[model samples]
Target: MVSMFRAASVAFFCVLSFAAAIAQPVKPSATTQGFHSRARLIGGGQQGEHWLAGVEITLDQGFKTYWRTPGDSGLPPRFDWSGSENVASTEIRWPAPKRHEDAAGVAYVYGKQAVIPILVKPKDPAKPVRLALALEYGVCKDICIPANADLSLDLNGADSERNAIEAALVKVPLPQALAAPADLSILSVAPLAGDKPAFTVTIRAPVGTKPALFPEGPENWFFSASHPVDGDHFILTVEEKPKDASGPVSLRLTLVAGDKAIETEVSLDASDLPR
Candidate 1:
């Protein structure tokens, strides 16, 4: 009887321990000194046209964070939303990041506190939307530290916070043309010779300054790394990823001139830019 009672007690203790583990909440590490993160809904709880979700990160006194493209070193921030419902789609609108040089190499980042505005569209506007974000990011000072946070927010109704955030997002700066009155006129698009399909785009710009072109789609693709050929105008040698060739796609080009910014949009066939 004594042995049987002892075995029963051990089984009960095991079940209690498992229950405790399940009850433990997942939260951001408190040991880290310099980094902080928060998420909030912008504008009021009204499902108005669209809702903007804001994610802000503040680095510790001496620490820094990485950009989408961390350059040579540092890990990019990861966001997971497995628990999010009522969210039809999520779009992350990142302000242009800055380049930073360190002992290891140059890195791109948004310093101080960076606010990333996300546009969320709900499938059903009447029902309240609940959003749970699981985010992991890396911060570096003398050494690198990984931090995480589980952020939750609800869309109650239309409000002022949402309006303020939307306003600030609208004022974010974009790239501009280097020359005065520089205009980007799309001349034509045509296919290039190769088994791997590609498109060549001809654009007109003011003489002297070389304007850089970037495509808005395919978040995995980086336009800055692709070199633009200079002649009487600018020509972009672009290749479409296999699955992206179904129909027309909108392309946005940003021309950076010191502190000035200019942007233009064009629509092109997804198959390839026509010759």
Candidate 2:
């Protein structure tokens, strides 16, 4: 079993709450949006062993944004920090995402607004770190629109926004060891009959529980909708194993039932499935 924690890749986190985990940058940078965004930094501008940097994004009413795993269709958020100076690296800490269902389709997005906390590490502890962010994200309602923001911050000392940053950080999912809850278990995994080749995930959960299985891993992997088999069981149709696959592909599954959710990772191989 592997931890579901996904380190920040490149600049920002599109995953549930990676933005709060390791999103690189220093200080609090915010700018007025010309379109549907007004993003700025909160509780930053400090030099420490690790700075708790955060971004607060507000969208126009009725507009929604996407999560790291957008389920069937949606755009994930992206960040670029190439414009920064005296920066070592950053990671995005993600909070659990909400499941959204609308006429367009099912999408994973934040509620009305999101306060994403990022963990930043500076190259030189003595000099102030400068952070520049070029953020690209999508907001949708009846139609989808792509938006961008240019925000930068200079870190010298801590701002007085710690309450908000600390609050948002609490929503981030913590690393959990693999466990088989008494009421639910993943039964089996195998390839399905298809020309393109896809696999099926079978699981058994207590009756009447609304079960949802979400896939998290490689960007190329695509997971389909979950199909109910019975009150005690269901199945997930996932992307086909690449025929030219070299090594095993690592994947994670989030099982949400009622208010409780379990996050676990396993390789999509026969050996990894439960007997």
Question: Which stretches in model 1 have alpha-carbon errors above 4 Å?
Answer: 1-48, 158-160, 171-275
Q: Candidate 1 on 57-133: residue-level lDDT in tens?
A: 77656667765555445556777767777888777765655556666544556666666677778878777777677
Runs of candidate 2 exceeding 4 Å displacement: 1-29, 45-48, 180-212, 225-234, 239-243, 256-262, 270-275
lDDT tens digits by residue: candidate 2, 1-275: 00121122212234423543454443435663624767776555554586667777788888777777765566677878888787788778766677777654457787568878887788887777777887767676765555666788776576677777777777665443344545665555566665434566666566677776666767555555454556544445544334345456677776666545556677765343222
Error of 2 at 132 (Å): 0.8
lDDT for 94 in candidate 2 is: 66
Worst ten-residue run, lDDT, model 1?
29-38
**Model 1 residue 142 CA deviation in Å:** 2.9
